[model samples]
Target: MAERPVEADTEAAGIRDVQAQTRAWAALWRRSSPSSVVHVDATALSDGTGQDADDRRRSVRDALASAGAPARDRDLIDDILAEPTGAAGPCSRFLVVAEGEQLVNSVLSRPTVPGEIVAYTAVPDLLPLLLDRRGDALYLVVEAGREGGEIHVLRASQPSALRRTDVQGRADSLNKVQAGGWSHSRYQHHSEEIWKQNQTLLAAAVDGLVRELRPRFVVLAGDLRAVQLLSDEFSPGARAISSTVQTHVRAAGSSRGALDEHVAHTLGKLRKADESAAVDRLAAGDFENGAVGVGAVIHALQQGQVDTVLLDLEAIGPRTLFALAAGPWVASAPEEALGAPVLDSVPAAVALARAALVSDSRLMFVAPDRLPERAGVAAVLRWPTGPAVPGTPRWTQTP
Candidate 1:
């Protein structure tokens, strides 16, 4: 049918957000029985019920049917169109991804993105949405003030704040501190104590969230003294990942747009930091718990040793890899993965991705040249795989 461009939205949305959805679906992609699942990625022509919409729906249906998409999942197109947002008339693009009988997820947005439909595939095709999302995974923003702080946990992919917990501190409505007054010293001390308690309370709340979510980014904003106190009171781990903003974010009449811009900037900084950390590790030859090339990476996946698979698709996507109908999921040669007349060969990127997903490992899509030359695929392991003791269970149990 109509092939959607995978890199269509890369410039608008960052890669971190794309990685979030990839992991999210990876968690769900492993549940199906072998050769039992197919993913449907489709975009509707219009959010309307007129003749044009009818023709578009028919076209999608015919294309999917021709491509052998399961009728059970193909019907989800109607269910997706039946959703309330379908009639909202404001969305510029509507996306639906389905697996077997499950309507996995749908996203409606107001960007001038192209409309296309992909019926189904053995491997969940994440490439199309990779560049098309403007959302981020998990992040935390603390808007601190005299009243305390609002700890907001956000995932832009979803509609609203996933969690917002407020830490109430003493609102010391300090009217005035007259130096000449008899009670001035006592009043000043009491006010200072209230401020201290407020910041301490805020820090405790933030620390709890940091430990709970281990968010991708954490930002603190408010009065300088209040921010400083909160930062100082925070747990070391929390303070290490958090950035501070001078804006009075929680203040009445504060601009949300401005705060969002600052948060986005922080996200960019964190991404760079992560890239640098990975670069330094790899550049220093830190392969003790990592794999550096395609063969080693495939072996790591076979052993169920990977935590995250780093891929330079530009270098590896078009290459070929063999897949098996049973355990030892993928290999460069059919014989290595238990060759059979029924064994299938698939794109290297797709085969490795499926292996990673089924093993509950993550995928990190890096810029093409970020990887060392010829090291198109690599992985950081969950644990060491070399020199295992006899009788040890080295592989993740495959379904």
Candidate 2:
């Protein structure tokens, strides 16, 4: 792996810490209560010099006004976007989620947008806040050596890294001198045995790590021979997702940037592979534990059968769907579908997202072209959807 360039300590560079910022948003997602949540996404129009600044924050606030957010809440948004320290300097966009007058959460970051403002009152438009954080998650990094190695465990919720564990096995005679005699041959045999023993133990440690954290992937790097030995020792399950990198974190000239980039690249490949596999399942007419189309997906959500929602939010757009105010949150009609009173019609994406949220299911965004079926809605379910029951539904990854 090649070394990636580090930032030159720009003012907003801290905000670009993807791991930390994403965890912050994920925590908010779990803590927020469903209500009249106001979500706003705005692109900066220009420098904060009078009118040009308002061009960026205007439309969203007007939309908020139309949606009837409390006056105080509306003013708060304007004040933030108006301040030079708020959304203009070093940051290119402003995103916030509020409830009534109190602000719930806000994320100011460096994502460029030409001209756009969005204000939606629903299950907190988290998709936008989290969109840039794809295929990034906790993973383990292993630096192998003939004698032993080091393992780095990254935390999903923390700032960046969590802990490092060193597994040092026997190093006796690791570098045997060729004395051209029986003793030399004996020392060589001892070193080989030590290396194998080291790998065997290291593989066990890795197995425990994979079982414990279920990391997105494991990165192995170090001396070629030792790395291959350790890789070959992994159990079938662990070997499936473990990979080798040319650059080792412990190498003399290695920088953290290189290892970090490799981990990220490995994560991205895992995501692309997963997306392809899921799409294949859908395309192959494998609906046993799958659901496609809006109606089926919704029914599965209401029934708590959905495990993951494969969505194409851009395709779903502004379409709305009927939902219930109480339990069994989604329904097509009041008396006919569910006994609960009618909940306000919600954007189709949010409805599915809300249902998935309540049921602890995941929402995964897929490419629009790949999801031309089912109104851009599909799922991999907890159990086989099996035979469609004539009514229910066609019935469904990541943190």
Candidate 3:
């Protein structure tokens, strides 16, 4: 399979887009008879030389063959194998095989982690990878000045310039006039006015971006004055999402490696803090709108009450959960089947993931240590579950 190179586009993808894609893949998986799905997670950056790349491709091909991929899908395999490797940043690729065709192929960056290969009955279990790749913040680098400035927007560590403009304003030399005492002061005032005007322009741009992107966090880096002024311009909503880094825009550009390291560190901290908070809330016995076990999470998901389903990845292995093709419910036993007919017992994680997607809920793969419950699964509800108690023992019965 020769890997195909996928161009990284600048357009940001929203949650709705992810949901829609998941639904589409789910549908494809359901329709393909004997869906020969093959998932290969390999490094886009090769460790050695050309031989290493060849070895990588051969390994992927061998894996695909072992996964029972039909020979008719060779072209698709080739495309997947040929994807450009050795990019400066982290890269991950996903290919979905179904209906004897390559339905979806995407090369992603960030979360530059190790890779693996998996062959599932129908759809590839992509939920964890997707969740891991999800962006937690939007980085906006703005150049300071009244005359010219550049705005670069980075989501999920992928950078793209969103806006650039020349902000005509008073020059510094105008404020440097000597011996023209009163005139110097007047020029200084003029320079201040120009700076204010520039700030207003930048503010308007930032406001529009904030409304459009609606990112979880807004990271601002550049001139201190510009950063402060832009921060002031943010709406209450934007202000709530904004954060700042000390690095200047030019310095960040010159040393992208350092900037990325800083961004990663900051985001890592934020993610850990968030996971802790969610775990705390779940453990608070506030079972009204949250669940602490697999059974409860399944029940909430069935009722479309789940807003975010959290899983302790370590606790969940290749366990299977019976679910239907068209419903957002999963059961540990056949006797617990809901209204929909049983499709198959999919990987527990995949079953939960499909259910979440069907209900338009988010999925979070949490570390085992962070989870308060040893049950391996939990969920945050969109609405309170009222008197409904989860994991009541009866729900786990075979009959």
Candidate 4:
């Protein structure tokens, strides 16, 4: 994505708008959830007579009574404790009351604010009274310090399942016919017993991974048998399964580098289908040159001749498209075209332009090297809304 620099005025306004929006959203969210209002009170008393501890405690109880909060017969004290307290912060003295497991009252008395109320609240009391209370699925972790505090709320994404394996094996071989002889290709493989164990293990791993990532699709990569095993080891609710029979040069536990490459390749292949189909319809003399310069794409978009925009995310493209709200034809420019900030890669910029064309605002990524020259980086012309079919290619050229 392009990093467009904002002017000072715009940045300040944006900050204010974001703050207002956050408050509005928070209010809406609170109203959407089950919650209640609560109040809490705390008090301390003077023990001026050098009286016994019992007398001093009685004075405190009398103070509480004076506050119109008399002890009830069925009241349950959740806890009560006193300790050395700070002069201007939270106190080490507090009490809690509960009716069975439900909190009813929570009060804290600060030593520095003796006889005067410090800080107290009753959510600690009324949470049990609230309906539809989410369990420990949610939690707030806070780090407190002098510069203020930071609070992070963590919540479970969703529920999912996976398989657990009970066994594994060394390796196996696959039959192959070489140029001059028949031979066996050695690779890591599992027998029926090992396969069963893997199925369980994979299922369990997939289940947990799905819950955490909440991905729309899951990709499986490895040798042919491993791909087959992945198909047999499906987890619930995953939308699609794609198997790639590629050698895994990276370690299984070190899945980051190799697995990422596999995902990129698989997704690229899936997107390439559209480009390939478009290329098939190309006739002789279609492209002025083998190259798909920026101007050609802009002309195509202007003529409403694009159904899909095939782009390579890793390459630098000379031209970029900008959509204006008023018309079918879009404005085109060179790199950082028309002063619009360019994305990190050419494919990314093209993807941004393609997103404008998708009904649901989704774009497919592709490798630039995969397209035929005649249709290279071209948008598939949409019927009736696009340019008419052109003549045959002027020259046969590779993408």
Alpha-carbon RMSD, each predicted model:
9.3, 8.1, 5.8, 23.8
Query: What would you estimate as the lDDT of candidate 1?
Result: 0.62
Q: Taking the tens digit of each residue's C-alpha lDDT, what string does model 2 give over 132-176?
A: 444446677888998888777663322334556778898878997
What TM-score fits each model? 0.72, 0.64, 0.78, 0.28
TM-score winner: 3
- Candidate 1 C-alpha lDDT tens digits along 1-399: 011233424312322445555666655444333221222323345455567666766666677777676676557765555445432434433343454455344554434332244545444444434434422457888887766777777765545555667778777644448776668878877887788888898888788777877787788887677788788898989988888877886667877777778877776665666666665544443355567677878888888788877777777746778755555667888668754332457677767776776677766666677776556787878765555356753332221
Q: What C-alpha lDDT, on a 0 to 100 scale, does residue 59 get in candidate 2? A: 65
What lDDT does model 2 reach?
0.64
Clashes of each: 0, 4, 13, 21
CA lDDT of every candidate: 0.62, 0.64, 0.61, 0.34
lDDT of 4 by residue, 100-179 (tens): 23222222322322122311221111211111111112211221111112222222211111111122322232223243
Q: Which parts of model 4 have CA positions greater than 4 angstroms off?
A: 1-305, 311-325, 329-377, 384-399
In model 3, the runs with Cα more than 4 Å from the true position are 1-51, 110-115, 118-120, 146-148, 157-175, 178-180, 232-234, 251-262, 280-285, 338-344, 388-399
- The runs of at least 3 residues in candidate 2 whose Cα sits more than 4 Å from the true structure, single-residue gaps closed, are 1-122, 129-137, 155-159, 170-186, 255-262, 283-291, 303-307, 322-324, 331-346, 372-374, 380-399
lDDT tens digits by residue: candidate 3, 1-399: 011222334343432234555567456535425544444455542334467667766666666677776666654665666766444665566666665577656565534233454453554566535655553455555555444345555555344443333344444543334656887888777766666666777767666666875555666666676667767766888688667776675544355554566667767877788787776666554455577677778877777788888877667667789867556556777777766667777778778777776677776778776654455778877766565456662222111
